[model samples]
Target: MGTDVRDETRNATSLLESNLMAAAKDLRNETRKATRTLERNLMAAVNEIYKRITALEQVLGWYRAGNYNLYKVFTERANYTESLENCEKYGARLAVDGIIDATILRDLIDNLINSTDYGTYVGLDDRAKEGTFMWLSGKPLIAGEVRWNSGEPNDDLGGGQDCAYIRAEAWNFDDHYCETKLNYICEKMA
Candidate 1:
């Protein structure tokens, strides 16, 4: 009878051990699945942050000039031709757009000049013929379309005063010698 009782106790203990082992295995599997889900969600959040940073960097690279996004760089006094060349390197050109565009440039240039002796060069020129002003693209300037400083484009200064510049005081267009070194503004498509 004693031996029979011991055999029954051993059998019950073995069955309990088996049940515990299976429960532990199931718990480990569930933990692994939860870990995988957490990793996937974290990676998605990091990727979204990276995309937003890139967009902000692009916006920081440019500046607002009225209705246009422009890149303005201060350079050592350079000839009109040299200024144009420099602008070309950055995929921009000398600022010579419509009247409204030019006006915005004038305001910006005026603020920058602020009692400085140097002025800024624009893309307008009469190189094709004196008194026949035109934008750099060869588009003729309509007489009343653009405002010029009093007694400007007079060609009175001589020495090939044909490149248009912004006068600091009036912020109006005035022809100057192309060879004169000065600061300049560059424009690009927004």
Candidate 2:
């Protein structure tokens, strides 16, 4: 009877150990599932925040300098023609060439576009006739009013760089091929 009792006790201990092991495994699996769900929720929240920020930025027009509102489209890149069209959608025009406007644009570009190795298209271009740069407002860019990059107005490249752009590091207008796709800035009257 004593042996029988000892055998029964050992069997009960073994069963308890098995039950504990199973419970531990189940807890571990549940913890893992909860962790995965939390990560997914965090990602969704982050994406929503990013979308909201972008929408807010569009409404704010990027920057307000003097009497004009400047907007730089750094995400979407397009050629000279396409850029003009895009600006039209926003009820604005490609940035024009004026002393104050150019200065404001240069400062904005220096802060934003300078870090990237990309260029931003400006409104000034000599597309209709070479060596005669004109702004989108039908006014020619007068010499000495605004500075251009050193050795610029070099329309000697392929197809002659007719479109003007503000380079990243230089922050000065330089002629570029009209067909070359690049980021662009838009201007609206405040």
Candidate 3:
């Protein structure tokens, strides 16, 4: 009778262990399925966003550079004030960051533009106070951050060369008259 009781106890323990192991295996399989589904959904969303951006780039002629804003090169020539207004109409502003990237600006010009002798107008100007250049965003344009043209940012005579522009020949800032009509780059800043 004691042997029979001992055999029954052992059988019960073995059954319990087997059930627990099966349950654990089932839980792991379910977790893996959930993770794979989440990964697939994330990839699909990313692809959709990429397609929309590509379509907009083609239609609006807006180009984007590495870690930079989406910019559009307007061939229509306009002076400083007019260019500012034009960018505003499109719900954007001029690329008037304190530090301008001459290489990216040059790539946008050389690759996108066909011809322009008047150069392109940026938002830097000394209009508020003479000899004190500032961006359109009310930030001062640091001299060290810019690649100014050779002997640039100088007014040969009073009220001359107050506005800054990027020359087509090279990607460097050159002071120009505010009224000079030139191509522009309207940047949609992030």
Candidate 4:
């Protein structure tokens, strides 16, 4: 009887030890799972907050549209060179996206064509070689892809219309002289 009791006690202790070890492993795994879930939830919340902040920025007169960064329009008149310099000073450059050359600005602002009588400067020029236009981003402006105003980019009697200017009334590039002062658009990455 004593031997049987001793055997029973030993068996019970071994079983209890095994059960405790299994329980501990299970608890560790659960803790790890919970931690991962909490991390994911925190990341999702941070992303949502960022989206809300971006919306608020738009409400505060910042312009943004498809595939473009936040845009800042300067109504104050400035020449083409000055416009470039001013945009650079503010850590930006002239609006020179491939889409902008077409008709993206129209969607960016309602009635943008009729917004004001003043025209805007873009980061396009053929100063490198006459009749060879290119954007500041180093992308070539294929002539076939764009619509030029009546007799535009003519260099104005061989005076050389190197820079590109977009007249407000006309959505297309009616164009203007580089030396001419006008309102301009600046773009910074989002």
Candidate 5:
């Protein structure tokens, strides 16, 4: 009888140890799953933050490239004489005979055209001689390079007007009275 009792007790102890070990294995598996879930969530949040930062960086780059810098309408409203005075005040001059790239010319056209009823005088004119439209900066106008409207520089009505203006459509040139009170576009050294 004593031997049988000892055997039964040992069997019961062994069974309990096995059950405990199984429970410990289950706990470890659950902990690993939870850790993996937390890591995935953290990585997703980091990626979202990185995308937002990249978009903001692009916007800052555009602002720094002078895309937003433009001439105001008030500066363009003065006539040829007042426009020159205003340009001097603002440390700039009218768009003269200079090597204008596409970007600057596009900006000038978008900003200066159609701000008023009258055409605005640019820094180009043929006041010195006929067929000699020169920039106020003392540069000669090159032939076959002018973007003039059909039948332009007519010196219409017998040569009273000599100043140049970007037409309302911003596609061609027109000569107007230099003393006419119209807006003007000014260019400064960047």
Candidate 6:
């Protein structure tokens, strides 16, 4: 009778051991599956980031090659007259109407204004016709896109203000006497 009881106890212990081993195996399998899934997601994210970086590099390459038009901002303060002289020295001109796009405009606003306190001149002038502004490059001004400061181009002001300068605070334009001293942005043919 004691031998029978011992045999039964051994059988129960063996069954419990088998069940524990099976459970451990199942847990290991699940862990491996989860690890593989995480690896796949990480690889995909890295690949996507690499693709974006490549595309941006291509664009920068084009800019370096002068295949795309770009705006170069100057922080040195100089009047429109001096700005034009400096542009000639660098083989560039103040940005004209055709060059005004959202990208360039935003860049100019952010870079020029955030970096300096002096106003920078753009290539806008109403020298040709009163109330009809035209860029120095002879393109008509697009009405809504231009940045003009309050009470600007009021040519009636005794000071002969004819040129426009970009103010840093709000990217607004203010007409000054063409001879006023201010920094300028030059655009070269790209």
Highest TM-score among the candidates is held by which one?
A: 3
- Candidate 1 has its poorest 10 consecutive residues by lDDT at 57-66
Show how many residue pairs clash in every candidate, following the order shown: 0, 0, 0, 0, 2, 3
The digit string of per-residue lDDT tens for model 5 on 42-122 reads: 999998986676566445421111333324334336667788788778676776532244565555555444444556567
TM-score of each: 0.60, 0.62, 0.77, 0.76, 0.55, 0.58
lDDT: the better of candidates 3 and 6: 3
Segments of candidate 5 deviating more than 4 angstroms:
1-76, 97-103, 111-118
lDDT score for candidate 5 against the true structure: 0.67
Worst window of 10 by summed lDDT in candidate 6:
60-69
Q: Which stretches of candidate 4 lie over 4 Å from their true place?
A: 1-25, 28-36, 98-103, 109-114
**lDDT of candidate 2 over 1-190, digit per residue (tens):** 9999999999999999999999999999999999999999999999999667657765764655544465555548899999999989878888773223666655666555665678888788998888898888898878875568898878865457899888767677789988899988787655
What is the per-residue lDDT of model 1 for residues 35-109, given as tens digits with 9 covering 90 to 100? 999999999999898567556634655344565456454357789899999889878888766233666655556
lDDT of 6 by residue, 1-190 (tens): 9999999999999999999999999999999999999999999999999668657745642121122454566767787878888878867788763236766676656644456677788888776676677887777778776757787767757746778878777677877777777777776665
- Candidate 5 all-Cα RMSD: 13.4
Clashing pairs in 4: none
Model 6 residue pairs with clashes? 78-182, 79-182, 93-187
Q: What is the C-alpha lDDT of each candidate?
A: 0.73, 0.77, 0.78, 0.75, 0.67, 0.72
Residue-level lDDT of model 3, residues 1-190, one tens digit each, is 9999999999998998999999999999999999999999999999999879868876888777554577777878999889999999988787764226666655666656435665888778888888998988887877686888887777755557788888878767888888889988787775
lDDT of 6: 0.72
Give the C-alpha lDDT of model 3: 0.78
Please list all clashing residue pairs in model 3, or write none if there are none. Answer: none
RMSD of each candidate? 11.1, 15.6, 3.2, 3.5, 13.4, 12.2
